[model samples]
Target: MSSSAEDPNKQPTLYDSSSSTSQPLLSKLNTEEPTIRPDPPDPDPEPTQFLQISYNHGPRPFKDLPFLILFALFVLSTFAFGIFLIFNRNPNHGNVSSYTYDTNSSSCVDDSLNLSLLLSSNNWVLFNNELSSSDFLEYLIWTLVVTLILSVPFCFLVLLLLKHYTKQIVYVSLPFFVLFPIFFDVYWFVACTVSSSCGDSFPLLYRILVLVFVFLIIGVVVWIFVANWHRIELTVNIIGVASYALSRNLGLFVVLPLLALGLVFYYAPIVVFLVFARLNGKIVPKESDGEYSCVWRQDSWVPFYYALGILTMLWSYTAMVEAQAYVISGTIAQWYFSKEDSRPRLSIRSTLRNAFGPSAGTICFSGLLVCAVRLVRAAVDSAAEEVPGFVNFALRCCVNALLASVDFLNKFTINFAAITGEAYCSSARMTYELLKRNLLSAVFVETVSTRLLAGIIFVLSTIYAIAVFAILKGVAKLGVDSYFVAALAWVLLILVLGFFVNVLDNVIDTVYVCYAIDRDRGEVCKAEVHEVYVHLPISRSHRSSIVPRPLGV
Candidate 1:
């Protein structure tokens, strides 16, 4: 067989220069300018076309190992402290009774030292109690179950809609996104002015201030859309390809929900720790009114434990989210590099192995950064309430801006990490340089695809919630608590559907990075995708300097 027709995956690999230098790791996929070497003496030498890609085998060295160790230590210490708090009996409560069914009594049951009861936590308690009263907890569980059941088919429907109506959805949703807030503000203002009922509630000055703020926000939205109008076509194409890729990898839908379920299980122990923390406090009787209150023991470590618990929750949640992104990106990158007609079988198992098995530390490191930002935001919010001033407001704005920038950059950084298997810092630097070279701002698609998906999910979830509300109230004869049931349904549907959209967002990032690599290497990994993405407008500065004609041009 001719060398051109040889399986590229079997060829001897060229040593990557990126391993030795600070160059972007993925740039090794293809060199922009090939180094010259003397031709081999073999007269039968055949020209070959190949891209050297290596598959990672077994377990690789952990990236960001210290962060992983720190997170594990925190998890262990928090659980140990929670266990101590639960088992440690309050010396003052000598004979506090264990919680049991006492039909004859109507007072609050004081089960101070029952470790099992405290560990069972609020959810189980609420489930048992609410079963008899309004059955609110039961209804909520059923509502969430129904939402999960419906979300699978609903996501497939969304994929179909996006595939067929990408342009229509973007054009239509962008208008609604812009106009809805404006209309809402205007209607509220007019209602306050015309209706005596609400008119007395909102003072003139307050109403005027709200209107001014709303106008400023709308102005910013309009400016962003107008500025990126040129890039909307490219965004539509990317979303279209993403929808197609998602459709091909239908199993991706399950990956995220399963990850989410795992996340819920992870939180169960944390929830127990939080509940037991409060229960561990001592009961102090009030001197003024003789009422008793559970006051946390005056230990310095108590406050620190609370803070640690919060950080643990946020960090674990963020890490789980990053893991999801990594899995999706890895899967999509596999699909992107495959041949259109004769693509190899893609295995999400391998992708999962790479993401969670080898690169788990990278996910932990990224999650820590996000968790720290959230901690800062929470502190700023508290301070804002305590010290309401210009300086405080300015600080809050600057901090929030920093948070947004990190989040935006992290999205692609994680995607690139998924592709290259590099550590977080190295992947971040490389991803930034690649995007800069391509002149592709991640901001344009962020404004369009995410908002459009969010609008669709919101509308569908709200409609579904309302339909459930009607059934609960009209058919089941439920009372006001039916609203709560419907609201729970709404949140679940949004969460499930939002997970699906998140997969698509990761697909977009993966495709763009793949395209950047394909463009850089002067090879087309997938021709149809390249044809569509090739239309991405290049800035004039780079267009003049040796822009390689896209594959087959």
Candidate 2:
């Protein structure tokens, strides 16, 4: 009040005697009789001050511990199953008989011989007994031992190459790589099959040439290995590096979709049968020979619609395969020049987002293939039913086989599209050119690896199904019906087998395509793969020229 009265504008001074009291707060606030005050809390509290209870922490969701454990278990299981499949005589509980593991038949004919001679000598079984199996268990043991022994050096070599590849790979084609030929080839195959119509099957020369191509490619590879072991090492290193990247992102790329599709495919056949049965009661189950065989009572719809549905399914499968190629090739290519340790992490949600949209093109491709084949197959079926004989059967088999081969050629288109991100026709053209350039290696790897793997995986999966049957029927004695158990095992086996082999297939194809297209990078040059060659086991050639490098240096 006094200060305000003196001067409104003047600031009140804290220690000015005239304007304000010089308050010595410590002395002013002191009590005369030592008044007691509540003690301030200690800065360092006592350890026992708080109550600590061990409450139940509920089971965790997809977190670190669970994921780690699950991943570990999955890897171990996959490895164990893979080893057994590779080595054992994939026992067949389904037939109380398994693999026709007969070495005596195919052993006499050498795979090294020319295609014509090989075919003349019953080359039908030329590719049979691929792995050594005088005694299945013995072969398995040796493979396992050899695998383990080579693992260390193999890993070291891969690590070195990966270090280089992390900063070397580049894109050659535009960013639209995918589809017109996917379904296009299906149409082409159908047209060809029908044009050549009736009872005349494909020439044995076609088969012979195919077999020769496979044999020559593999033989050349072996020769190159002996001559130039380094090429093999480089090739392996590339595969290893690509495989590692693939495995890291495989959840979104391969496994999830495969299982989902497997479930759909497995159930679709049953649903179709039920629908056909309910509508017409014509689809009847008759036990013929050793097992229950269901036949759709002949009318217009039985074979026509049935075959249509089947063909449509095959096309859908092809599309999915193409889609898989898109994701896999991109992932491998994108990470090709990245540091191995810090390669791009594939987020499942985001990868799905990216792949799902583009996948529609492939789906459309499949639908087209299905439609074309549907028309052609209808004719084929009508003719076959009218004229029942081996000729018709042979025609059906040969045409269908051709269809299958043509369908598989989509892989080439897929590889091109994946790398260049180009449109379908362009990709196919380029893919053709690239494969033409790297013909031997590309064909050999694509066909042989996939075929070998398919057989192994099929055998393995069948064995798995039978094993499950044994467990459920013989040991567990579950109340579930044998057929139900069989169905469950069969479906699960399909999914698992499909997942494992399909991954390898895509990987091999992508790597080969990438290597082939980059062939022109030049003498000093842009061949991203050359960086890998620069590591150890260097090659002078720019192309992955099927030449093997020396074994060691």
Candidate 3:
């Protein structure tokens, strides 16, 4: 037995050994290698490694490069054309020896003054002189200075109010929004009836038509309110969230205004060019005796140049607005993604850099698309006016529908681009897909918020304007047409208020897009916000696993 155990060929079996030898067998089985032979290795040793490319969360490659190049070319061409017009002006090209650059002075006077005053001062050289005088300019400058001084504080106050009292403002404004249209339509109907019955009486059918239209509008307004009742809460929350974001990023106020002011300065020279293009015409005799008018030269490129300047203005304006939206969206997105404990790297300057640097091409591309749509719509509308028929009307409707779709798509595309730093087409594609997935949610957000926010801005702006006018009345000595100056101030105030509201609107949009992204990724960003927004309409198939936590007080 000892010899058998010592032999390597002999196997250790429990049956052959006594109870004491069982331990040795077990130890041998545990310590020794297996009896079964290993299978042969495969022929190839190297394995394939898969790589994935995903949407960038950081600065991406410059997108819409060709559009950027085209934008540059447009600017250059516009300036070149303006220079050509300035240098190559020929008085004899159209007809006469003299040139008159003041083509719009009469129209300007008519537009600037009230109707009664305009009729009274049709030939009032003194009135025209007053308009062009240095003293009047001084007064205008003073009014503007006062308005600017007032507007800044007022805008800041509006921001504060929006941040702290968003729900109150929304609740207060919705009634006004619903009522104003009805009130306006009713008042107009009454005025039209009175005007027709008392003075310059027209057909009774006209009044009937007006009454029917007013009723229809009022009905539509009521229906809209009833339909969107459930969404009001969500809209308010969205605005509240946006207000919170804006309050946190207060520097945006200064940056956006500066950008708008810069755009104004840029367009000043373009206006001069437009004025010069008007001067590139020849003096010609009118049909009336001892009368002359400037007939633009058929051979001259003035018309083309004028159109180009107008196009540039539209494109540039769209680009600036998109850029603002981009900045706000990006800044808000950063705020959304940042962890509560981590030091915030969110800077408006960095966002601005991203917007004007790598993302500029995207902005330009979106702006170009919008501008093209607007131009097409304008052209179609003009043609429709010339040729009034069902066919033309149908065509007009089709064009309008197309333009509206583009405009709507362009808005969210910019929002997505700002957030992801993606190219224009890529951003648009993603945004469309995202919205498609959450169509009802997107519609709910857009429909419920726009009217209410617009109402709030309008009311606040009007109140601010009225106060500004009162201040101007007390301070300024200009006796007559003070309301005109007040109206100017009012327009400026509206623009300021509109801009602030636009920032908030962008914030709302960005939040929605970010929420969509987080849900898709099964990540919870800004858990507090998610708690509020997760109640939005979501399809069963696309329901996310991101569980919202209870909000901390």
Candidate 4:
């Protein structure tokens, strides 16, 4: 905004210089006529004002350190309580060395199991009932089959729909995501109320739960895989080129699969199963011999912290998923834009350290965000269970829906923190403005890329699982159970594919974040989006800041 006296006839035009140079210098002005400044006019006042919070430069209210610490402990306490409740309610209490965990940090609960008897044998007891464990595997298998059936079209349809109606879809999906939880509870309450007796009521409830769980898990999984399809596609297409160019960093190829395996070992079957049991419905606790209580034989502090550590480790993995994605994006961007790069020096070790080390807290914060949401959901779920009414359950669902919205919004804040090295609330204020500015692109890229990559990962994982299973069965001679190999395979694929694909996930995320922050200003020459990609799910544009370069640029 020039303060010089302006001609009354000169209309305040939104100037954009035809000059392509990003770093503009007045000395390089060829002619007197500065056709247009190209500087983006100030952002729309509505969005900035709409997103204004108290968090800003001159803040002097209170410290969040103590609050964060207490919040972390509160989350850990919930998990610890749940674990204690699980153990106390178990029918196989005598079988479990409940006192042993007091001494042993590793084995909190007895995992003594015959994989053979559990997986292959027909005679098996589940939860003190005659139901065979095979049922679970079958259910999982069926769910996978159905997911596969729906995934192909579901993924591609999103691509097309986003192309034509990106804004509408984004707006619709967000609100719909919030409403889904409410619908889930309303239907759940209805189902439970339909049955009066314990025998009929519980089974129906369980069935409905399992089905709903399957729907959600499958939908979520499929969406993620397909959204990130580009990463795998990129890797396959450029395998020779990238491998040759960055041969020194070739270890990433080997390290990725191994890391995937480690992540899989931690992520799959057990964690997923336990989460399902906890969230799906309440497990029937077995009868205690004398008293209906198990005294805390040891300090409860130990187990709770242990659970916290576990949560930290798990969420840290997720956090790195975002960070490493940033790393890859920066690397590729450098590679692509460098005009005279004989060989751009990159110490992979140093890069990894920087990504994970200094940004460790940011990563943890991302995880904490998840844990916080889960803790809130747990509290709501507990209340819903204790007070059997549609009203309570509906409220729970509404809260959950809002939390889901929060989680979506938090990604931008997390990205801002990751790049700019800001605190949570600080990043949040920035995220609010960013979203208001580039809401459509943010929604499209995050939603589409995540799902695309996840879908691709699923397919790749299935193939990898098959290969691994065959090798294990034939060579190792460890034919150790039904769907164990398959399930393990799925988990491994998820981890490996998820980790790498999420790299693309965060890349797309970061690029859009940058776009949002840049706010229709600057030479976004590096982000020369292709017309074809402009229609693709993840890269779809909203006629805003995202300017697509002609293909083959």
TM-score per model over all chains: 0.72, 0.40, 0.72, 0.45
* TM-score leaderboard ranking: 3, 1, 4, 2
Clashes of each: 0, 17, 0, 21
- Writing each residue's lDDT as its tens digit, candidate 4 over 1-553 gives 6666556776533342433544335434656555775877546444443332221112123223543465456446545554654454434433332323322342244445535544534444344354334554544455456545544444334334434554444434443432444565555557566656633747766866765775776577546545654543432222222222233233454444455566667455335334423332222223367423222232344354446545655564555454554355334333333344253456344335544555445555665676668778888888888898888878987998899888877766666664454566767886665554443344545554455435444544555556555654554433445347556546744654455444445445545554444333322333433211234233233335534222243
User: In model 2, what is the error at residue 69, expressed in angstroms?
Assistant: 45
**Candidate 3 residue-wise lDDT, 1-553, digit = tens:** 7653566666657555635544655666677866776866545421211111123356567777888898888888888888777776654442332344344552111112235444556768777776777554676777778777877787778778777887887788767665666675666667766774533575667767876887787688778878888878877787777788788788788888899999999898888887767667544434346554444444366788888898898999999988999988887777777776763464677788888888989999988887788788878988988999999898888888888878878888898888777788877887765644443257667667777777787767656666756876787766545667767876877777777777787888888888877655556767867877888876444434323223231
- Pick the TM-score winner: 3
Q: What TM-score would candidate 4 get against the native?
A: 0.45
1 or 4: which has the higher lDDT? 1
Candidate 1 at 150: error in angstroms? 2.2
**Runs of candidate 3 exceeding 4 Å displacement:** 1-59, 91-125, 128-148, 178-216, 281-299, 435-440, 462-491, 539-553
The ten-residue window of minimal lDDT in model 3 covers 45-54
Candidate maximizing lDDT: 1
Instruction: Report the lDDT tens digits of candidate 1 across residue range 1-553.
Output: 8744656566344543324445654575568668799967655322211222222333566687787888899888888887887786355443234433233453234555677546568778887676757556667777788788888888888899889898887776677666766886897799788888777888889999999999899898788778878877877777888898888888877777788899899889878877666554453323336544333243446667788887788888999888988888888887887777754464588778877766888999988887777788889899999999999899999989998899888888888888778899978887765655555555656667676678767767777887999988876756868978888888988987887788888888788788876765567877778877777655544433333435544
Q: Write the per-residue lDDT of candidate 2 for residues 41-81, one digit (tens) a residue.
A: 65764332231211112221221233234323433443443
Superposition TM-score, candidate 2 onto the true structure: 0.40
Cα distance off (Å), candidate 2, residue 400: 4.7
